[model samples]
Target: MSNQTFKFKQFEVNQDQCAMKIGTDGVLLGAWASIEKQPFAILDIGSGTGVLSLMLAQRSSAEVLDALEIDAMAYEQCVDNFEGSPWGDRLFCYHADLAEFTEEIDDQYDLIVCNPPFYSEDYKTENTQRDLARFQEAMPFEHLIESVSKLLMKDGVFCTIIPFKEEDQFIALASALNLKVDKRTRVRGTINSEIKRSLLEMSFCEPARSDDKNVINTTELIIETTRHNYTEDYINLTKDFYVKM
Candidate 1:
């Protein structure tokens, strides 16, 4: 769990240079994000160590797997990791602010994935880079959704992971931009633990909702039945990426 290199099934991520090291949230989002559309281009916003982009590259035939990392150290490391990955030819990293990148990039993506900064609290840590990576002020949900709404293709899917408490608010914001929820999974560490995170899949195009039944497919995911004893669903969802799943 130290800020060091993390080895996966098909690839290894060097995280020594990144303030925000690899975590379960990013891995879960990468593995759970649907790629059924067979996207040709993919974008990973706030890519951190570029692990999400790497995972998608390994799972799909995306010719263009681009990652955006604003932090200088993380961005440089992301580029290096992308170059070292097996999908080096397909993976590319952009070291620019998301707001600017969204404005400058004219091409739309078939799939857009993000493990965005979630915290919106007023606090500061001794380590500024970590704070920037973890806090919402660095890239608020508003800006993230606005950019995704603009950059996503007509049929493209946008997937992300956020706090369970923020699910309602986030979905409401997305709805305002005409992004409808396709699927949602509430995540918990253990069966007894309160819901911790939410995995969301949204798109610009969605069929009309039926009054008789729910339109957005929703489910619950328990990561572990007990400490280090992963649940069957959790293993199945992340086995492709985790080294010892």
Candidate 2:
């Protein structure tokens, strides 16, 4: 696959040499990760193509943004993308696993976002690059939670998108590390379909009044409709990155 340049509202991502190309999961996590007050330091775990890190750069005024990737190809692609971006000075991609990055970094981050591999099944693909980008064997839920628990600051927000079926289990894992879910949004292709993915934001301290289930859109015509015609909300959410969205 060739490296392609994906244009966003405020940035363009050049992802020619990445194992995981631009996908809905990365775009959703990038657009959905909250940066309300603007974080000072941010971390993107398993940063493939550095899309989420770039999105966070556009969303907040963070001085330092770092990305950690275990895959060598993805790490190189991330470094290239970051260096080509305007925020190259502040954005750095480390060619290391998440656990290693967490152990070496002494600084805490106010925002930590990850588009983790959640497909915990006994399956394999012919494409080794995609497998490395999509598989979560090296970094399980427990391992990620423990690493984040140690790296996240007192008021930090750890954001991620996981399969809806694993939300309960994922939350349970995070809770073991004393990280409570502050906000979550269950996404569906349409109003009638079952929820497919859950975008969650967690923090060390439980909110005084935590809310549940912030449904984003309820449109039936997107998936069932023609290939080219997408829903308004879906288009709105991804218009910035997708070429024709």
For all candidates in order, the CA lDDT equals: 0.93, 0.81
Query: 1-245, model 1: which lDDT tens digit per residue?
Result: 68868999999999998988999999999999999999999999998899999999999999999999999999999999999989999999999999999999999999999999888888788999999999998988889999999999999999999999999999999988989788999999999999999999999755656653437899999999888999999999999988898
Best by TM-score: 1
Estimate the lDDT of model 1.
Answer: 0.93
Give candidate 2 misplaced runs (Cα > 4 Å). Answer: 1-3, 206-227, 243-245
lDDT of 2 at 51: 91
TM-score of model 1 vs. true structure: 0.96
TM-score per candidate, chains pooled: 0.96, 0.86
Which pairs, if any, clash in model 2?
Answer: 3-16
Q: For all candidates, what are the clash counts?
A: 0, 1
Q: lDDT, candidate 2, residue 226?
A: 43
lDDT of 2 by residue, 64-114 (tens): 999998888788888988988888889998898877777787999999998
Off by over 4 Å in 1: 205-214
